[model samples]
Target: MRILSFNIQNLRLRQGAGQPRLDGARDRDEIGEASALDPADRRLSAALLAEAKADLVLLQEVFDTDTLDWFNTRLLPAAGLPSYPHAHCPPGNDGRGLDLAVLSRQPVQLTSHANVTPSDLGLEAPQPGLPVFRRDCLMVETGGLTVFTCHFKAPYPDPDTAWPVRRAEADATRRIIERHIPAPSQGLWLIAGDLNEPFEPDAEPAIQPLLPPFSTDLMARLPEDERWTYFDSHSGRYGQPDALLASPALAARWPDAIPQVLRAGLAYEATRHRGAHLQGVGRHRPHASDHAGVLLDLPGI
Candidate 1:
C-alpha cells in the first residue's frame, strides 16, 4: 500500500483583501482565502500529491472537513487525480485550525485523540498543563494497518524550551500508541507528518519516542544531503522534519519500503522562495511549505 504525508501549509480559502491571511492570521479557524488551490504553491502541492499515487494521505494544517473536501474534490481532481472516496477530518488542538486530516481510497476507521491531554494520559504536566500532542494524533485503520498521523510541536526560533516540550509530546505520543498495541495481531502501525525533528546521526535533539524499539524512521537509508525535506533560507539550514516512521513489524514485513522525500516540488534555493513570494500568489518556489511531502510504499500483507 502506498501512503503519503504532507503538511500542506494551512490549506485555507482565498482571503479577502482586508481579511487575515495565512501568514498573519491569529484565528486558527480563519478560512482565509476562497481557495488556495488557485495559487501556485497549492497547485504544486496538489501536483505532488498526485505524483505519489498513494492509497492513503495524511495531511496536516487543514482547516476542517470543508477545507479538506475542497482539496480532495477540487484541487486533487484539478491536478488530474482521482478523488479519495473516504476522508476523515476531526479538529485538533491547534489554535490556527491547523488540524490533522486523512484521506483514503479504501475504507478506514478514525478515532481522535484531541481530548487526550497530559492529565488523561496520567503524565506530569510539562508546563503546568499543556495538551499531550501539539496537534491531535489521528489513529487511522484500514485492513490490518493502523497509522497515527501527528504534527509535533514545531521547533520555532527557540530551541531550549521547544526541545523539552517536543520531547515530552513525543513521549506522550509513543506511550499512547503503545497502550493500544497489546499483541502482534493488532497489526502494524506508523506515525507520519511534520514531526519537527531530525534523524541525523549527530542530531542533538532526542526523538527517542519515535526510534528503535518504538518505531524506525524509514528515511535512514538515504544519503545525508538527500535527507532534507525542508529548507530554511533564514537559517540556511536544511532539515527533514517530515517523515514516515513505521513499526518494527511493518518494517520487517516490508523491508524494501523506504520513505522518500519529493524534493522536486521544493526549490533548490531560498532566493526562489522569496522570488515566489514577490512574484505573487500561486508562484510556489520556496514558499509552498517549508516542508516537503514524504511518501512510503508499504507492501500489502
Candidate 2:
C-alpha cells in the first residue's frame, strides 16, 4: 500500500501572493500578488491529491470532518481514490481554521481517537481553550496493520519558545503510542505525519527520546544522500519535517514497503502571475504547496 503525507498549508480557500514576509528580505514586496490565477484554489489542491495516487493519505491543515468528507467524496475521485470509506479529521489549533485529516481507501477499522493534551505531555498548567494548541491522533487498523495519523505543533523561529512546546507535543505522541501498542513487537504500527522536527537524529532533545520505542525513521533508513521530505519556500532550502516511524516487526515483515518520499509534487516551479512580474521573479500562484508529499509503501502482510 502506498501512503502519502502532505502539509497542504492549511488548505485555505485563498491563494497567497509571492512569498511570506517572514523572510525579512522581501519587505518591499507586498506578498499580496500570490493570489490564485483562477478562483478555485481548493480545486487546485484537490487536483494535486488526485495525481498522488496514494492508497492512504495523511493531510495536515484541514478544516473539519465535514470538509474532509466533502473532499473525499468530491475531490479525491479525480485523483484515483474515488472512494475512501474511512476518514478521520479532528479540529486543531491552526489560527486559520485548519485541522488534520486522514483518508484511506484500504478499509480502515476505526480503533480510537486520542486528543494529545498538554497534561499528557507533563505540562502542569491548565490547558488553554485555544484550538491552535490542540493536536489529535487517530488509531486505525486494516487487515492487521495499525496506522497512526498525527500532526504536531509548528516550530516558529523562536527556538526558546517553540522548542519546548513542540517537544511536549512530541512527548504526548510517545505517550499515545505507548498507551496503544506497548511492545511494538506486536505488529505493524506506523506513526505518520508532519512531526515538525528536523530530520536530523540529534536535532532536539525532546524529539530524540521517542526514537527507541517508535522504531526507525523511514527517511534515515534510506541512504545518507537521499533524505528530504520538505522544502523551505521562504528560505529556498530543501528539508524534511514530515516523517514515518515504523515498528521493527512491521519493518521486518514488509521490508519491501520501505518508505518512499514522493517528490513529484516538489518538481513544480512557481507559477507567475499573468502579465506581471516581481523584480525579475514571477509573482507566485497556482503552485501545489510549500511542502511536498512524503509517502510509504506497505505491502499486505
Candidate 3:
C-alpha cells in the first residue's frame, strides 16, 4: 500500500464562495469553518491526489469532517478522483479548527485521543496550563498497520518558546507510541503528518526525538534539496515540515521504500505554462498546498 501525508493548508473555502477573503464566506460565522480554496484550487489539489494515487492519506489543517466529506465525495470526484470510502476528521484542540484528518481507499477503524491530557502523555504545558497538541494525533487502524496522524505544535513567532513546547510534544508522542505498540520491533506502525518544524542544518532541529530508536525518519535519506514539503509564499523559501515515519519493523522490512516529495503543482512551470486553472491562482500562492505531499510505498501484510 502507498501512504501519503499532506498539510492541505486550512481547508476552508473562500468567503461568498469566491470572495477571496475570510469575510467573503457565505456565513460570516462560518469564517473559520469553510476552506480558503477556490474551484481552481480544488482542481489543482485533485490533480495532485490523482498523481499520488495513495491507498491511504494522512491530512493536516482540515477544518471539519463535513468539509472533508464534501471534498472527498463531491469536489474531488467532480475533478476526477475515485471515491475514498473512508474519511474521518475528529475535533481536536486546535483553536483555529485546523485539525488532523484521514482519507483511505480501504476500510479504517478510527480512534480519538484528543482528550488525552498533556500530563498523561508526560508533557508539561508550554504556558504551564495548556493542551500539548497544536492539533490532535489521530490514529487510523487499517487492519495491518496502525497509523498515527498528527499536526504537532507550530513554533510561534512570539516569545520563541514554542520550540521547547514542540520538543515536549514530541516526547509526549513518543510516549504514546511506546505505550501503544509496546514491542516496537514487531509492530506495524507509522507516524504521519505535518510536524511543523524541520531538521535542516540551519534550523533548530527539533524533530530528532521521534527518530531511530522510536521510528525511522524516511526524509533523512533524501538529498537536502528534495527534503522540503513546504514552500513559503512570501519568502519563496523551502522547508520540510511534513513527514511519514515508519516503525522499526516496518522500516527494516522496507528499507528500500523510497520517500518522495511531490512538488509538481508548486512547480507548474515545468509543464510549459500549462495547467492554467491550477497555476492561475496569482502572485500569492500555489494551487495545491504550501506543503508538498510526502508518500511511501509499503509492503502489504
Give the poorly placed runs of model 2, Cα more than 4 Å off: 13-31, 38-44, 79-81, 109-133, 199-205, 267-284
My TM-score estimates for the predictions, one after another, are 0.83, 0.76, 0.84
Considering TM-score, which of the candidate structures 1 and 2 is the better prediction for this target?
A: 1
Q: Please give the CA lDDT of all the candidate structures.
A: 0.72, 0.60, 0.71
Query: Which is better, 1 or 2, measured by lDDT?
Result: 1
* Residue 159 error, candidate 2, Å: 1.8
lDDT of 2: 0.60
lDDT of 2 at 113: 38
Q: What is the lDDT of candidate 1?
A: 0.72
Return the top candidate by lDDT.
Answer: 1
Candidate 1: stretches off by over 4 Å: 14-38, 126-130, 183-187, 198-204, 268-287
Per-model root-mean-square deviation over C-alphas:
5.0, 7.0, 4.8
Looking at candidate 2, the ten consecutive residues that score lowest on lDDT are 19-28
Residue lDDT tens for model 3, 1-301: 8888887766753335554322111122334533443455656666778778899988887778776776787666766778798888889988777888889988999877777767777666645345666678777988689998888776546325667767766777877877888887678898888887843422545666787766888787797666777766445566677877888888888888889877655644233223333444433333676667888888665
Backbone clash pairs for candidate 2 read 16-34, 17-33, 17-34, 18-34, 50-79, 62-99, 93-131, 93-132
